[model samples]
Target: MDTRTVFLNACNEIANRLDGFKILEKGQRLKKSSLDKDIYFEIYFQSSFRNDSSSILILPHINIYSKILKKWQIEQIKNEYSQGLIFGNQIGYLTPYNNWKEWNLAGLSYEKSINEITENIQQYLFPIFEIFNSKETAIDFLKSNGTKFNQWSEDSISPLDFLLCFSENETAEAFLNNFVNHCPYKGNILKLYEKLKTQNEIDLNYSEFHGADKIKLAFIKGLKII
Candidate 1:
């Protein structure tokens, strides 16, 4: 049994049900822009064959984009927002639940797996996606939650990014320095701070940021107060 074919065929049926949805990544993903707002959603069924050939585990990875934020990111970086993959807050990681949904196509049959996954999309993901349809909501959530939104907190670099996103550069700089003061890998992460703490985006290493991380690059570069 071909797991990839099974996944793609199910994704095809899901795509047809959404009005403006487009199949992407050769049918591993679906993308749809909000009709009334500048937000967009992409739910990539990150699928892989299980040890048994007849089943696959799909982690429904979601992304929500704010076109306004993308514009700001691009205008600062002197490039298009993204000609490739767009990054949003990885809301899945923000939550505590396990995201993997298994489809035992051979055992469950195509009808059962497809309908169940579709229900997951509609009942689970849709309500979550609806809350983040604009930059206002995105910004509000980040600002309101502060450090709570990130599971790793100060141990991770996201706190600094979150601060920087809100233009709290002085606070971000202080936070990075404070984190480096306590980190075991101070030398390496401190080097990152040195590269990132500068007011000059031109002096920064462009080659280091790639793919989805380029969004981080744009956010860091857009900092006016750092």
Candidate 2:
């Protein structure tokens, strides 16, 4: 009935429906571990303020540590690469409390808010679990759909990020080289190319880059050329 209770109930419902996933960190998060145990799918809820109303931000993210690649190796790709990667375009859902304000004003039940939260998980987050059940599947999904580094950011990891983690130095270099030719951010791309030319390993400090700068930095970091 309260916001926290409603959110926890929705998380519980999702956990119950999905096999192998259990709630963690109190009722705020849920995770399903991989065979390696270090890698997993993590879903959590955070509170955000926007548009003059409190909103719930539901995030579904993965943490991948490949047997072939050490965690540090991948972290070199993106400084914030602790969480594996996010798959597909439906990153997360932002459900606003304002939507339920009308019903609450009339003293009606908040079933609509509860149902909305549940549906958000079902429609946007549950499918991610189905698609990325395994490391291989997760990588394959990225290869097929993660060409665009449009929303590259510290908080969001892209498919291209995963490819760098799994690819060899020569392969990663080639991919970045080709991507730079067509990518919109020529200055940043050239900078990365220059860095890759001399160094085998590079750290992409996101703060150094802005706007499209982040996208190129991610490619350079992900490859970890050295």
Candidate 3:
């Protein structure tokens, strides 16, 4: 099945099983932080249970444009107030393809965070990965099925690029560090810090700061790249 078809089906199935669920538009505005003025199209689904507002599932989608349209898109992204949305926060996940390769997970707002949505898709999507055990196989799946992605320059890198094959402690540590360095919101930093700490005992490699005690993990979040 096509990845989009797979995704849409999974979402529709979820709506069918779960009461008060609704899938909204393909694009909508999302604000990352109060101080950060950039708006993102993260709210792709809205649920009546959540008061008819979107809880975005940020999947990767390739945007093709004519010369004039491309210029407009770049200009909009470059605005001083426009902060580029990072992975995990806004966009969720995608089926591995040459074109849309950065993310593959669905995201929920702080208000509508639900594991059921993320967990349900695993059963539907994981089997597709089983058929092709290699990275190339994954790419072939995307190239053949992902029409929008195929149009772009095939020079893009996949999520497998940064993922270290060896699951060493240092490898995980480095991954966490890079994640924090690129995060735009303090809330996410804290959430990831707690997640890391719960999963393993990691020393906070940062100095003290005011108001950090409230979050407890803030010290860890403030770690410098020393």
Candidate 4:
């Protein structure tokens, strides 16, 4: 299968299986004129691009906890598995070579467009794949697991902080919205929470949240913060 074909097929599978999720894969050429000078394109062959050619499915909402709570969540997930944080669901990329290629091409004249697209695809799919290896099983697990908020005052910096530090404008906003809705500290612990809520700049739903463990693990993995 071709690279575009692989991404398309993977997106289709993810959409069909995962609930409340959407697929984002485009098999089109991005215009260089509209992009920054640092972006470029790369060729992908079906067989040789073993690690380079892959798919990811993101949960978007699985990373819905405050910074401090996220730290505790990581510890909890770690205790359950004998394997360290790098193994199992917390794994970041397909392999070492793939990650090396990504980092090497992150910001350059020949990496602007394709690299950006590749990065976005990776972000969207990996977490979803981890959470929902099997659609029914994932849904069932989410239902059984559920999301819960924990104290937000334990640590000064958190997973949310890390995501915000690295994420793009809109992505950071979405993550902050999730935190506003799911973080549990009250009164004075979280000054940011109060500011975000009172400002009403973000769309936060006051529903029963779930997946304390997954949310925490994801934040810990992505943020690289305890």
lDDT winner? 1
* C-alpha lDDT score of every prediction, in listed order: 0.53, 0.47, 0.31, 0.30
TM-score for each of the candidates: 0.55, 0.56, 0.21, 0.21
Which is the winner by lDDT between candidate 2 and candidate 3? 2
Least accurate 10 contiguous residues by lDDT in model 4: 27-36
The parts of candidate 2 lying over 4 Å away from their true place are 1-10, 17-19, 35-38, 48-70, 74-109, 147-161, 167-187, 195-202, 205-207, 210-226
Candidate ordering by TM-score (highest first) = 2, 1, 3, 4
Winner by lDDT between candidate 3 and candidate 1: 1
Candidate 4 residue lDDT tens string, 15-40: 44434333333411111110222211
Evaluate residue 124 in candidate 2 and report its C-alpha lDDT on the 0 to 100 scale.
48
Candidate 2 has an lDDT of 0.47
Off by over 4 Å in 3: 1-46, 49-166, 185-225
Model 2 residue 63 lDDT score: 37
Each candidate's root-mean-square deviation in Å? 6.2, 6.9, 19.3, 18.2
Relative to the unseen true structure, what is the C-alpha lDDT of residue 47 in candidate 2, on a scale of 0 to 100? Answer: 36
lDDT, candidate 1, equals: 0.53
| Pairs of residues at least 3 apart in sequence or in different chains that clash in candidate 1 | none
lDDT of 3 by residue, 1-226 (tens): 4344434544454445433223443222221111112212222332222222222233423111122223432453233432232212112233223232222223334313334444423432333323223434433443333212223222121221112221333433444444334435546546644565564544322223322221233223343221
